[model samples]
Target chain A: MAAVLPPQAAPHEFLRARTRWHPLEIVFWLSTLLPFVVVPEYLQLASQIAIAALFAISLDLILGYAGIVSIGHAAYFGLGAYTAGILSKHGIGEPVVLLVLGAIVAGVVGYASSFIIARFRHLALIMITLGICLMFYEAANLAGWLTGGADGLQGIKIGPLAGTFKFDLYGKTAYSYSLIVLFLCFLLARRLTHSPFGLSLRGIRENAVRMPAIGAPSDAHIRKVYTIAAAIAGIAGAVLAQTTSTVSLEVLGFQRSADVLVMLIMGGAGKLYGGILGSIVYMVARDQFSGINPQYWYFWIGLMMVLVVMYLPNGLLGGLEKLTARWRRSPT
Target chain B: MKAFSLCLGGLLAAMFAASGALAQQAVKLGLILPYSGQFADTATQMDNAIKLYVKQHGDSAGGRKIEIIRKDSGGIAPDVAKRLAQELVVRDRVDVLTGLILTPNALAVGDVSAEAKKFTVIMNAATSIITTKSPYMARTSVTTPMLNESLGMWAAKTGVKRVFTMVSDFGPAHDAEEGFIRAFKEAGGQVVGSVRFPVANPDFAAFVQRAKDSNPDGIYAWVPGGVQPAAIGKALSERGIDTKKFRVMGQGELTSDEALQSLGENALGIITVFHYDHNLGNKLNRAFVQAYNADYKRNPDLFSIGGWDGMHLIYEVLKKTGGKTDGEAMIGAAKGMKWESPRGPMMIDPQTRDVVQDVYIRRVERVGGKLVNVDFDKVRNVKDPVKARMK
Candidate 1:
């Protein structure tokens, strides 16, 4: 009804309308490139934000789109990071290959874990996810020879992208590499979320009890989206490990899982742009606040998250959308 | 949307860019430390020492005023440490990097230091292989093996022949065990037994009882400076292990203030070895203690001495290079640079660029109703055993 589609409109035409790019979305992504010309010094921070945004989007898939809460998303993230780190340490230093392998490893692990995840919802789902992350953290700590234990995995040598672009101190290569990967993954996520499969996922999220009667099994849908989200998160973690050239136990930390969730909530769930915008705000706030008071910067980040959730309940992006809807309630 | 995107992008780019638009005349030093977390106290002590050094030395070396940029790492977040290092080198254009506490954080910064060819002085990270990670790095902090190896040999020399070893399982703890066993065996001592416990949130009751049951001449254990010391001390006492007869030896933490508070009268005869001690009877140390007390109003620890010497080395190297901040020139001058520190005479080992200092053997005894580790003997000019054996 909202789309004003004719009763006889073809399914393909409806799909096309749903997949059409918003002007703001296009402009927003394009603006990420401006840092290359304007602020070369901040390319490092830019790349980190891009990776975090990608991570947040991955969480949005399972948590926002599928209505599956995950508190231990870092399991996939850490797996992907450690995969890249371990491979690079063992002489498999190609960046592109490492990224692919990281995704594959995380995807496989996510698929294996989805059996347990698909059986639970809400409180149970959160507990299982958290427990899995704790297991990974302990395993990494116990296997000091492989993961470097408390000292962290050192001497991770990520080879140049395309055999030409080196990871420089200025972070020009790292930013470009991260941005490209993020865009490719973002496009895939966008396509997947626009299909009939995505509609089924929303149906399952809206009413799991009625979804099975309509031939959309909630478990299957959750499994598929959770795996997809894990793979995307894996890509993000790979980007981070490759760019930084070091991986620590903190990659598997609960703090990371919580922070990303906070990001998604602040930006608005189910809105792709919301996830991206939230990450930018959170990361930039951290960079700025830490400069003023490095000792208590976390306090500022916490306050900002609280303010966003309080004033804009559904999130900043939701609030913005509502305000825009009111401003142009009818076409001129 | 384009307008908003442009505005957001412009604002961020402007902010980060504005930070870099500072005057470049001063020699900038970027201090990356865990300033607000579990290790905050250690950061505070080390930071205070760096400040005190600048205050005493008038903050200028070789006609260049020192500009400090402090960054809080929070905790053992290696990625943050690495990113901060990169930012310091590229954005802040810092001449030297210092004040890293955790060994892992230092390891994370090693790549940046190597790539940028930035001279880095590690003030407190104690892993022996840290200096090996980057040629541009030099450590003023004592390595794990430096203290543990000295303790092992000293214990053997002073007639404790059989020993049981226990350490919290981690990188430095492994180093501690390896150093002690190798030195003890080399000095003609027998290791009766050994055990490793979890590094985080470990209960020492079972481990302590097991070590006590081994019935060795002494027990050599290494746990980091935290609640672990007090916990282990309580465990040892609860197991009825007399500290007077059967010696409990370690790398400083065994007789720390926390251990004394927990162990009580049982802490009377426990022996430990370390590079720096507040109880050292030298005039320079006394002055350092006095000045530190006047300024910070707290007793300076081993971490403080490391930062003090780090700042001193930075100052001396800058003076020698006449304000050149290049990695090669600074390191060249820093190597084998000997000075009389508050702790004692120390030098930077020319080949390895690691600290070579006196390791003191101290016994906990009550003096004027206060529990203190009084210095009984010393090992002069001890080098990190790992690097010494390697090269």
Candidate 2:
């Protein structure tokens, strides 16, 4: 009965658009299967890349879609890692149970921290998140009896997946386990980003002040996304713990958070597939370049990052998307 | 996305091409060490030591020519070490694995070695428990506790009644401090006070001040790596604490060749204990040091000795097993084997698979205007009590 449409019509449009499957999505999922057939030896590397990608995607959920810039994302990751490690060390070595437990613990912490984080904007949020991560880092370091101090949480024996398919030295089981987790998480994230709630998050990200005028509880929406993102991050960490069977102080380190941030940016933030693509690129490049000259690998990595940031403002995926769209539009 | 995938595929192809050059008949020894960053200097020296040994031995152990493939673990990140260890095992198909400076990296690699059923020889990591993590693992290097106990006992015996202890706040530091304290207490020496400083602390004046305030006869210190020991020596000298008046005793790295270079006269007369000394006055050590000095234009350090001994251990085992790369056979050959190393005679304890070697107590002295460790006392067949006590 409305004569004219409101300014924010995309949330309604998103519902209809979500039903059709994107060809790119199918292609993306299918490509992951290639590693199993093509290079079975690099399964461990592939698994690590998947874990890092998941972490980057989690960061993207908050930073890219919700407009919450976090430099301390490792807080959730470390929490999840320690949770999985401690549980497995105590004999609860089932992968699913560990992932769920890790996610719950990290999600709870994220939800609690979200209340405080959602109130702040920009630099204050960054500082608070960094402070929280630092506190956890120190706690892990000081709790030597439980966490093994600086020596790392060792003696973790992760059992078989579904009581079958043992974690082989070749990492076939771990790769499949992480790939399936990543795929499921990606599907849920895809649904959320296309839903009304996700549209509201994007609305909040674009213009927070205007979002309030449109009757959206901006803080609550951001908080929900942040908690969801943190749960995903925890899952990534749990996967890492299960695959590696050990967690060191590096999980809680500032470097981990920074690396994820870099990965998210390089892959093109905002889009669902950007983080995974970016992780594949960054981790693979690092692996190759580090083998060439381990001492000066950072110099090469820095140069590549600079070139990407300078040339592609939206990131690698964004630039590629632009190129493909232009090609499709051109009279070829 | 397709373009990116194409690029990645190309890169992977290139990497595979580069890696496929190794011959199937050669015995590939995979060395994973930090080639850059904080531990790079020591790691490079260790690499050089291994290379020197191979070059001197005509590059053949038993009947097989050794081919070394190096992988850098970067730093202490266990995940990186674990991934690289897997790659070396599955992809590279390395016959033997060795090298890791950090304890965590060694532990991670040890786990990989155990899981993959590969023989891994540890050269530098001093964590006592690394030996127990994998049955396929053998440590040619000494543990922190084994290196420190001798100094502690010698200090107690040589009129150091009450001593103040200091160590950097980390795992190996804790091991060193605890080992020293235990032996000192057992030898009836009182621990006056102890303080742990943060790693890479720029200034040790406060710690030195605390030691002075403790009014102890000696100060037993365990500082972390990389010029910190030299800085501590400088700080002690600046504070005017004469070694003769109040003894400053610690592990060998406290006044090692690198520390002595920066320490100079300040480190002179300071007594410390270690498993390896450049001036051990033995035929093997003298030749090794001469060759090492001629090759690197620098003196040999603890890490260098570890790597040298590691090569010797591997060669000896290979000879015994007739160049067999079978993990069980290699491990069996290495067990309870004793050899005269550049440092001293060392034996692999069958129970622990860790080295039982002679620890030398050395005093820093200036010989011909060059500072070096002079062996004043020695403890023969010293074993790691921590490992002995492990169930």
Q: Which ten residues in a row have the lowest lDDT in candidate 1 chain B?
A: B15-24
Model 2 lDDT tens row, A266-314: 9999887889989999999999998887667888999999999999999
- Alpha carbon deviation, residue A13, candidate 2 (Å): 2.4
lDDT score at residue A227, model 2, on the 0-100 scale:
93
Poorest lDDT segment (10 consecutive residues) of candidate 2 chain B: B15-24
lDDT per residue as tens, model 1, A69-144: 9899998999999999999998988999999999999999898899888888789988999999999998998898
| Stretches > 4 Å off in candidate 1 | A1-14, A330-332, B1-24, B200-203
Per-residue lDDT of candidate 1, residues B262-322 (tens digit): 7678778888888888889999999999999999998899889999999999999998988
TM-score of each: 0.94, 0.91
Docking class of 1: medium
